[model samples]
Target: MALRPLHPSTTPLFVAIFFLSFGALLFQFVQTRMFSAMLDYHLTFLVVSGALLGVAGGGTAAAVMDVRARRPSSAQLSIAGAVATIVALAIETRIDPVSSGMFVAAGVAYVLGVIPVLCVSWVIVRALREAPEKSGLLYASDLAGAATGGVLGYLSIGTLGGQGLYGVVAGTALLGAAALLVPRPSRVPLRVGLLVVAIATTAVLSIWGETLAPPRPGPFKSDTMGVPHEFARWDPLARIDVARIGDLGDPGHYAFLIGQGYAGPRPPALMMTLDMGAFTPIVMHATDADLAVFDASVLAAPYAVAPRDSVLIVGPGGGIDVLNALRQGVKSVTAVEVNRTEVALMRGPYSEYSGGLYLDPRVHIFEDEARSFVRRSPELYDVLAITVVDSFAALTAGAYALTENYLYTEEAMLDYLGHLTPDGVIAITRWYRDPPAEIARTVGIADGALRRLGNDHPERSIAVLKHGLLGLVLTRNGPFTSLDMQRLRTFADQRGFSIALDPLAPGGQLVDLASAEAPPTDDKPFFFDSVAVSDILAGRAQLPYGYAVLLTTLVLSLTMATVFVLIPVYRGARRAAGNALPPGTVVALALGIGFIAAELVLLQRLTLYLGQPALALSIGLAALLGGAAAGSAVSPRVPLGLRSSAVASAVVLLLVLGGVPLVTSATLAAPLEARVVIAALAALIVGIPLGTIFPRLVAIVGQPALVSWVWAVNGTASVVGATVGTIIALVGGFTLLGLVAVVCYAVAAMFAPQPRT
Candidate 1:
């Protein structure tokens, strides 16, 4: 039998489906941003995993439930989901994760977070089941809404904050509910009431939500716990909080130490923190004497070697490094910072309080990622300084162990070196750990950069200095002179600091890269990850915090899938005798695993190229889903079988893997606008083929019962595939992850059912 055309009566249903998907995705993005600020950064991944698991649970329930029987309308479910979303946000936002214990708090968040997603999934599934003939239309509506949601989600974070976004999501859901009742004249009054309430609630939340439920820092965060913050701002990159150290009413009580153990004068300053941990100070009422305090700190070791005419300060938070350069008598200084919210705060709100540091005539500021700015810079500098730039919360929790840090990659070092004068030095400071993995990685990166520059002896171009938990690595384009080494040793000795590496001195270079540790490349930029699987298995190193969380998620996902999806579907299929396993089940499962794994790889790869994680995620997801929607719309005309779709997908994945290095090298210095276009095009190319697979498989398994079972299988596989993709990237990088996706598609091709003529 031929499928029926989309009827005019179903227009309202499709529109409601669109809003449902839009609200669901917006809710997910808001949850990710909120939890990222409230808990350890790695927990953000859990948000994604939890949402997918909820999708699986809801999908399974829909498969088992009788949709033909009278049940609650889609409009009723949408409204319930809206209310549940608000309640979940309210509860999760107020709880102190540290006091409640990390696991307990996370468990609470995970359990409550699933309710809204499950509700959304239930509505979508029922819509699909009711209109199997219009499956393509419904799926297209779903993707289009999700694509729009992703782009708007990124844009709204800067304007709405997390709490405000929650309100927007609720309003969107209510609007969807109203749309569902558009065909019923008798429900006109209810529709009008819902619209009015949604608009009013959204308006109130957008105006005052931040004030009512302000984001609180975790106890482990470095910001002051009990005191009220002077200023706070939120954006996609991070949350910036400013706190007055002492009595705000009395200027006499305001004092700042250059660093711990420093005997210099305590200047008046205000504390500025990023993500509640990476702290810097804004100097208030400072004089020449106050500016000179930086000269006494270990961070000034690079400037001590020789007089610098010009300086480049990367991650110059609170303008501390810029002030240090000025105190060293540099003629010009360029400060590049990634977070625009922090820059706005310093330039607009705290200008007078900081003595107009950013307004200085000799100082120039650029709001850009460190590596991207350096790669496109037109001038060379006498010194490049990066001082304790990354967030301490992320570092200590090992949250970034699986994430990319282009700033610490060998390619980034090469970019820095390329933008430095012959005598200029690159200075990087990090918290020193007992095992010194960070220090070793820093040295290895510098060494790799120097070797790539054709240096015969890279060691002569690098030096390391340590003072209390702070370690600084200095490297230059050219070798450090004997006189320069002598000056560094003299400075370290007088300050009671230790020289971990000095080319001219004997027994130098105490920090060596372990044989298993490799210098990070842009392809495998995991600078914080030093523990290998062998080490973990041999009892040489314990599992990192981030990995442990990932394992727990995987276990939970498996358990949920087995209980709610697999067992119920198995029993139902067994009752049907010969139809125990659906013909397209394997293909659906493989598509889910392959599609998500590929998406993750694209997201990670494009983040550095686009210069911001949020931008990359928004553009990548939108382009991919949009392309998939287009593919689904045109699937009927394509003269291809399921086997052809899988083969084509595998070929595209291979092309993408091979093209990554080339694309990155060519676009490393391109304008952001141009890079964004290229990245979108790349993702769209991959999504077109992937989108064709599922709709074609649905046509083969025409029975509603089997179709729902296959949907559950696909959803379950997605829940597990997310964790599996992360592990693959953790072990063998994105290249291996992409290859695994290709293998999955190939396996799907082997199991694909024959097309009906």
Candidate 2:
């Protein structure tokens, strides 16, 4: 079987498929963002898993259909998909996830969301089946379209709100339908109608959808904070909302308190929230006397320990930490915040309300990830303050159990220590839970960091204080002097705080570091995952929301794949007597698992290096998919067989796994543009070889009946791989996940089918 060139007459089909692919992927991306705003951050991955399941279902359905009978036109299916997308978006906004419960709401959302994807996939699968000779060109177009969609979707969400972006995706699908009409002059009325509908719908949604069905925070968040926001903005990072809590002139209404113990006259303030949960106050019109309230809190211990001249604040939300530092008479305060939207609000709109806090000449602000900024900075600080950082809902509900948090790792502690003056201290604050898991972990991390820095008795260099539900840990490079200890005791006693850990004082070590859990590292940065899987399985500890949701998704996906895809495909193959399952089937499944597992691992690994999760996702997906497109396009010209391609891909994946840490570390200080380019190149190196394997496997299979089955199996494998890969990463770290991916590709190489001569 020789490769065949695509005919000029198929141009309309090719263009239609491209637009359809673009619209589908863009819709998925926007949906993920919407879910992040509407639900919790950890649940966003469900959208990806849902899309994969839908694709597999569609491919299997197409495979089992009678090829000799008339099927729905590509144009008709495109229109249907567009309509489904809009309806799904509309329905999603009205559902309350909190009241319905996470599991029920997620199931409903997952079902509704997959309908549009299934329609789009059906159209693409039919086109491939109808033109098997053009599989290489068609697949290339598909990958290229998806890559373009991912990059553009990221940019679009920033400019257009989430609702506005949904309209664009629907309009893109309509445009794809219209493209198919180019070869059919008989469908003139259909073409005119589609153009009219596309333009009108896009205009209406872009202009008015925000008022009609704007994305809202979930019931869990909105119940406490109220439904309407004074100011709201959405970006790839997170949704930020500003609420005017009380009148700026009403001093009695705003009793500003610092930490838990401050009880003094304070200025009025506004509340700024992230994802409608983690909140900080924006104090309004405060004089020097009004700022004195900060000195009475447990957070003031670090400032009282020594005469601090300069300070660094990580996550200075609403400028609370900045105000505290200023109150302490610190000479310079540097604040690093990750959310650009939040930064804009502080410096642009709320600058007056904040009394020029962000605009102060003494206060310098950088919009960068905390760890990344610290890694690249050249200045040494007298005190590094990280107090009560992280989302309130996420922490309380254990939603960050599987999420990577680079800030609390031992490596992060080392980085913070390196940038501090010789006698400077690193101050950390976390909510003190029963059994004190977080506090214990914090102590363990500090102890590990000190030992790594060649300090033998870490207890001598560490101090901890507890006030109600809040606990603060202070770690110094050198041992705390007697004066420092006396100052800490005085501050704690004055504020009615208890010393949780101390060096010299008798019975000062309240939370023993000797029995603390193992410290988290950059390789396994799950600081919030205090409960082990074994504990949950043994019924000793309840399952966290994050893990519960992931497990539910996996179970549902597997069930759906088995019922809708695997059964039908198996039956159809059996009915076609001679059309037996080929060796390519195993190769297809392995490719699917290996490709997505490697991709998920790479995204996690790159998140810290790239400075944001959304940026890493966009860059990683686009680069890998774009490289795959190029590889698919050139597979016909390459002389390699399926086995050779699989072997080469396996080699590249292992090489990349070894090189990523080195590359990211060496280029930590590089410009954003340079780092983006380097990350893209790394993805491309692995993707090209991977891209060649699937198309070559398809070519070797030769039977059109088997091609759809192969595609279906690959999609199913991907659906499973997404959840399983995440589980592996959560337990064994990204290194183990990457190794498992290498093993998958190697297995595929052994099962690769020989091409017919």
Worst 10 residues of 2 by lDDT: 249-258
- Clashing residue pairs in candidate 2, if any? none
Q: Give per-model CA RMSD.
A: 2.8, 2.8
lDDT of 1 by residue, 1-757 (tens): 2222333688887788788788888888888877777775678777887788777666666667644355566788889888988888878878777778777777788877787877778777666655665667777787778788888888887787777778878888898899877467888899999889788767777778777776656655665255457877668877777877466322222122134445655466777766666677676757787556676677678887856798999888888788778878889999998888878887889888777888899999998877777888899998999887555555666666766788899999999999888788999988777667787789889888888989988888888888877789899878889899889988787767878887665233344552237789887888888778898889988888778888888998789778877677665544543655667878989988998999988888888787788888889999988888777767767888889989999999889856966896777778778888999898888888888788777776665556666677888889899999888887888888888899999999999987646
* TM-score of candidate 1 on Cα atoms, chains taken together: 0.95
Q: Global lDDT for candidate 2?
A: 0.79
lDDT of all predictions, in order shown?
0.78, 0.79
Q: Summarize candidate 2's per-residue lDDT along 1-757 as a digit string, tens digits.
A: 2222234688777777788888888888888887777777778778989999888877876776635366566677788889988898887877767667767777778988788888788777776666765677778888888888888877777677777777877887898898876556787888888888888887787777767776656644632555345787667876677777444533321232344556676777777777666666677857877867778766677887755788999988788788889888899999998888878888989998888899999999998888878888999999999977456556767887877788999989999999999789999988877767788888889889999999987888888888877888898898998988888888888877878887665232344533445788878888888887888889988898889889988998999998898887776554442655644778889988999999987887788788788888888888888888888889989989888888998999999977999899888778778888998998888778888888777777655557777788899999999999988988888899999999999999999877777
Superposed Cα RMSD, model 1:
2.8
Q: Which stretches of candidate 1 lie over 4 Å from their true place?
A: 1-8, 67-70, 248-262, 391-394, 506-510, 514-516, 574-577
Question: Model 2, stretches more than 4 Å misplaced?
Answer: 1-8, 66-70, 186-189, 219-224, 249-261, 505-516, 575-580
Best by lDDT: 2
